[model samples]
Target: MKREKVKHMSVKGGASLFALRIFVTCLAAAAWWECLFSVFPGMVVSRSWLYGAGLVLAVIIGGAVSCPRRKVAVPAVILAAALLCWRFFYVIQGAAAHLVNAYLAVHQERGFEVRFWEEGSLSAGTLAVGTAVLVCVPLLTILLLVIRWGRGKLVAVLILLLPVLAAILEGAFPSAWATWMLIVTGGCYLTAAGAGGRDMAGPAGAAWAGTAIAAVTLLVLGGVSVLAGRAADVIRLEEDGFYSQTRQAIQTGVVDNLNAVRLRMEGQDEEADDRPEEEEQLPREREEDRAEVAAKEAPSASDEQSETPGDSGAGTLPWDTEADGMTDLASVARFSPDGTAAVDVRLEEAPYGTVYYPLRWGGAYTGQSWEETSGEDGRDSLFLSWPEGLDRLEELCASWPSDTVEEAEKQIDRELTQKAVYDTEPGRTPTGEDFAEYFVFESERGFCVHFATAAVLMYRMMGYPARYVEGYAVPASAFSRQADGTYLAVADGTMGHAWCETFEDGEWTVREHTPASDGSASPGSETQTASDSALRHGQAGDQEKAGPGAMRIAGRAALLLAIVGCVIGAFFLQAAVRRKRRLRVLGGRNRTKAVEAIYGTIYDRSRTMGMKESSPLREETCRRMADMWDSIKEQEMRWLYQLVLESMFNEKRPSAREYRKAMDIYRKTGAEMYSRLRGWQRWKYKYIWCL
Candidate 1:
């Protein structure tokens, strides 16, 4: 009964040892993948197959040396330690960077998609933390191996449980890599246990246990691989979906709101023009007339009508020319049909080249009846004010030649326009007395009109001849192909826009101040505009093609295969080395040495077959052998034991016949030992080298 229990323990120990070997090999493979990819990201993409091959080679090497031999084990451990140190200090940062980039790519916020390599995406502090975590992976792996190799099963089990504890703590700060690391660490622990090679009671039981453990591990790993493949697919779908939706929203939202504002402004302008000529008097004249009218009407009017200020009639709207001082200011301009079309014209045509688009250039802000110029250049020049807070703009353009109007315009469009587009929120109207001041300093929100008005005023203050022009500006991207093969630009009320026009060489050049959906300033030149459109279209095409998705799937598949191949290869290599060692022991230099080797092998084999405590081998060898076998085998075992004792203690060489008989006994006992094992154990013994 005691012998049977020992055999069972031996089988269980063999399983553990096999599990440990596979775990170690997988850990090594993962470490190698991280190191290679991080250190050579560009090369990794093309030479990924080479990396996989290298991983297999590393595992084989690890297994060949991780045996009971002192010479091999000592050197392997030293080399492994050195490599771990090198990776921790030098390679960890790049690995961390790679992980960070992957995480951000999958989980970016809506409407703020940014490239991983873009500036400001990764910080020094984040890299530092990531490196530390990467280093910990190898450190933990080494600790697991040491505990397993030292036969500390309890400590080894505790080490395996670390990942579980980490998982419980992961909720505080969730990270995808943390879960992956836990899985990897857990696998490593199992592999380490199996690699120890001490728990098995006999070769048959050990082989059985190792085979069972390996099969289960492979199944679990396969499941994980399938899930990983699915995850890649999901990430790809999400990225494409979000990018398309966000792009569409930006296009529709900005275009629609700008058009609505433009139509409202045009309607108000038309209403103002239809008012009576008598009502369009100068500021002082209107004030005098209003006071006179009020005096006459006050006595006859109701108390409510009289009490209300600026009430031309009982049903006047609040926004009418009564309560607010804003109506007196020119907020909208009229445009001819051709002039409106010019706003949608391609930049190469010089849309503002010859047309004299009128703008509310020169105006004075009084409490009522705001003053306006006669729409002449001289009058417009007279009303242009260089506000006190414009030293910055002046300094920015100071380096330009006095006549470098084009260059100055380009500089302003590029710098200030981009700032307003990215920094400001659209649709926020200015409310302060100084529109330019409020738009630039206090308010961060506005549409085309607000951005254009501020830009025009800023240019004027900087001594540039700039004016605000309100018209329809259609992006070339919004153009439809006509039957004649010419592009016909489309503009609705939503396409109505306000932009700045700077005078240079006797003509006003259009300068767009609005930003596009991608947060870039509207292209300033024809070439730039076309390039921007093409780039956007190309990006859309790329997303539709799903190149990233394919790459992700391929990459994950390669990683999974590499890990599995390395582990299986390691197991085979270790088995081969053990077989070679056994053969060498059996074929010694002399007869006495051969007999001594045979006795030592048989004694060890007997102890492994039964879980008996250590005792003097010379005294208990025959007794232990008798206990392990049945009565029929005991007589033959005793004769074999006597022959081994004579050859070792008497320092005598056995005869050829005696040597042959001893060899026959060893083979027969080994076969009997295997046949006695359970059916599953006998089957497993044929494959795994637990002996």
Candidate 2:
């Protein structure tokens, strides 16, 4: 009963309503494209926002197929497409170049992790053809929905929500309120239209009513957006250590798999190279046994550790995986610590607590050396033996106090030292492809470098973008009080430190993952000679923008729901306006004209009744229309046409009774036309055709 009450929709506003839906459909698709492209603007090649908006292709194609009231829109669209292709030829070419250049990187303007791909190639002609195809195919797919709007609700919704969802996953939505409003407004109506409410096709007033309701929604959405923007300035959500670790763990696993695939595809024999081809019993070169690091003496990084793992080729030089997935650990393990002070930072205050000062970040670690690999992407993966020793490290970390980061790290200092020794087998160097594994399982010697390297992998396993860091560590104990009540400390290469840091709150923080210095075990992490940490993660809020959290995502979803409500209310209000308009014209002034208009409306609807090959039933005369009407309603159509003609051309206005009689005839004619349509066609004629 409820369905029947609003089921009979008028066909009066079908075309206009459908056109609006089409417009929004294209808009939604375009929005989706823009949002995604924003994440990787380099994908557009030209680095131009205008060029990135690939929806121009869809708009042109859609326009081509639409009626112009004079039927000449197709040629215009074709001309426009041609002009666009010619105008932005460079953009297309750039896109092609981007595709060809394997070792390419996006512009620094994007402020993304400095990304690099391999060098690949393609012919110019092939590129041109590829670009053309790429531009047209998706546009055609989007435009295909114009043929049927009362369907494809899911498809339409997917397009409209693409960017919104992408923004959520990426935590980077468009800043513009209008973009959100457009998507919400279009999505709301598109959802209703897709429900195929053929039984409730919107009347002429639906447009105005929908617009009004949508306007209110727009206002509300604007206010919410503004509040959200302001809230972002002051409110901060620091990462929960547990969740951060979990998320990073998942990400690291995925990165590890991708890296493995990439290595295999690139035919990298790095693993094979890590192992010696012939294990000839070559005489070991005599090397100095390492001494503990002290205020005056610095221990050799290479000579401090020895291999204890039973794995083949266990004793190898430290290797660093380059950003380009290549191993370049060809240098001997003897890198003397630089004695020159390259960087000097003066501190006016005495430091007492555990401090971390991050300098250079290395995203990839070779068995021997750390490399600033990949890009700024936080998804940096450990190159070799990435997670071999992660479980044990995580277990060890679990027993530490959670009261504070520093306290926990202190516990790590004592416990981790107990696990691995600082003494290397006399003159034996620690290095291998499975270096991390060896370090984790063998309980062998580990100096600052070993602890720093292995600790990074351990941190990564615990769900952090653990980056290897190497820089000078100024000793806090070096500070001396002055007469003016100021304290000063001086640092040089003797305080050189190699450690790891964790990504937190948009920047990296030095985490004391390396064991604390205990000179008794030959040397300790940061070395006995090394000072406290130097880099901190105390970044200001304005330094980097924060991504959306769960709460923000929920707010967006709520906004979407509110907009959907507005869309529905708009159509219902439109229905009421349509009724008032019908009553005013049919029963108030202009009786003859009103009756004539009603009959003419019914006559127009009749043209589409039988779904004929020649649409609009363009017969000039009522007799011709009757002749073409093959159904039993032919006589009824003929009578209705005659009545409409008489009313249209009548000289004198009709009386109330006469007008009622004409309306009666008009009502009967509408019923007859309706009856002529059978099954789904009846529903289609009432809802879809008018919709």
Candidate 3:
């Protein structure tokens, strides 16, 4: 009997201390809100005050109903409401809505993209912080639940590893590991929490096993990842150029074999050369007039006089004639009296004047600029030249309707302006022919080869002394006149473009129909950059105007949601705590049912106050109460109102004497008992989810 008395006394003392603690906590909470209000605008506003009042009244009524005569309920309800509202205010204005809106707004601005969190935004930092708080509250609540239930440390560990896990799977591996890791982590937490709920505290030995497994799994996964990464690197290197190198080596071997065969066959070439003269006699004799009436004299080392009038040499460069199948020039042309007679004949053989082969032309070794070097280690010579066939092209141009010629020429000119269409350097084929093959059909957008071939064909048809020139054409910028009036020019691959020189009136004249003089931008022309060209095509946006107004509204809405969520969360928790206390005091049978009724009443009040209370509230209750008060007016119950207001809004709760004085006025206010009871119950249920 004596021990029971001591225990009872201890309980009473503890209850009194609890009341004092609540009082102190109320004061501290109010002060915190006040401080926040000072920093942020509108802390003690009409809307907030109304909300806070409503929430506090609901909690009081719920507490009264749950523990009929317990005076402690009044303060408990008030304090809980205030705390919830405070938390909610910060969250809505600070976090969710604000963040979304800021992001939208920033995106609309030039140079204002959403940066990583570390790179702070001046206007949105506060809102971001608020959002951070919003996210943390739910996470913290979950953590608290985990801790209370004594779950496995997986939840804590995952929270800690969030950034690390995020970093690990950023670029590409997330799909592979993200879901698996999440499942593992969740399973661990659930198992631990379940164990705790069952009152079966997990053994320390189990922790060791978990750790061992985790370590081994991580190590195995890490090793596999490393190996895969290395293998990928190897594959990439092989793909880049290693395979090409092997193919080139095989090609080189084949070419060497061909060269060896040619060397061996060379001895028979002299005989072959001699036989042409004898065997060609019949055809030459029959077509004497046609063969003898050559279009141009034979080409010689002497520039001006290589054309030997009647001799015509019966020799030609492979590309000069209508493309012929004869790789052996002298043998093929020998049958024709002056080689000119073989033009139509050769056309039946190899018809393509130019052929293309893929090759690399620019890199570190070759220099970034195509004009810098011919090629590194002679590798650039392997590139495929875009086929520019001149013979076939001339045939087309010759047959072109006069009315369409100018327009066709203009279109071709545009093509020539492109870098891909023009050839600054010739790429040789496997046959070792340095000249790019040209055909009339392919050379419509022809560079120098096209122009030269066209000139040759036209000159032939018009009857003039014209032979294809294979030498490079240097730009005028590279030329300098010598004392003898001969011009010398720097001869580099870039300056080695093709063009034609026709022998007109005993002098060579240049003829080129390609577009504007290449890609070189004169120092005086700064506006000719690719950007400027795109601008002319109307692709650039205006940067001077403000971004769309929708972004601003979004930002504001984000801020508002965060505030509401946080506030509502706080209120729910307050109601939950009150219900728990009542259940403990009055016994679960009566208390639980009463608390439920109280919560329902509070919920209805919340709705009337226009405060949406989602299930599982994560907002502050006090702010909600304050917001509710603004929508009502009742002077008779002013004292109770003042007491609740002082408890929530003051830096500290009112003294007991002050509260008693206010209570006296409250009881005499003539408030209908049913209405007061309903209002109090409504406040409780409204925020019950916060628990």
| lDDT of the candidates, in the order given | 0.43, 0.45, 0.32
Q: What is the overall TM-score of model 1 with all chains considered together?
A: 0.28
Better of 1 and 2 by TM-score: 2
Q: Which ranges of candidate 3 are over 4 A from the true structure?
A: 1-92, 101-129, 143-198, 208-212, 228-691
Residue runs of model 2 more than 4 Å from their true location after superposition: 1-23, 38-41, 44-60, 68-144, 154-189, 192-691
Pick out the ten consecutive residues of candidate 1 with the lowest summed lDDT. Answer: 528-537
Kindly report which residue stretches of model 1 are placed more than 4 angstroms away from their true locations once superposed.
1-403, 422-433, 477-490, 518-691
Candidate 1, residues 134-194, lDDT tens digits: the string is 5433444454345335345455555544434432332112234534444454444444343
* Number of colliding residue pairs in each model: 15, 20, 95
What order do candidates take by lDDT, descending? 2, 1, 3
Sorted on TM-score, best first, the list reads: 2, 1, 3
Q: Give candidates' CA RMSD values in order.
A: 22.9, 22.8, 30.9
Provide TM-scores for the models.
Answer: 0.28, 0.30, 0.21
On lDDT, the stronger of 1 and 2 is 2
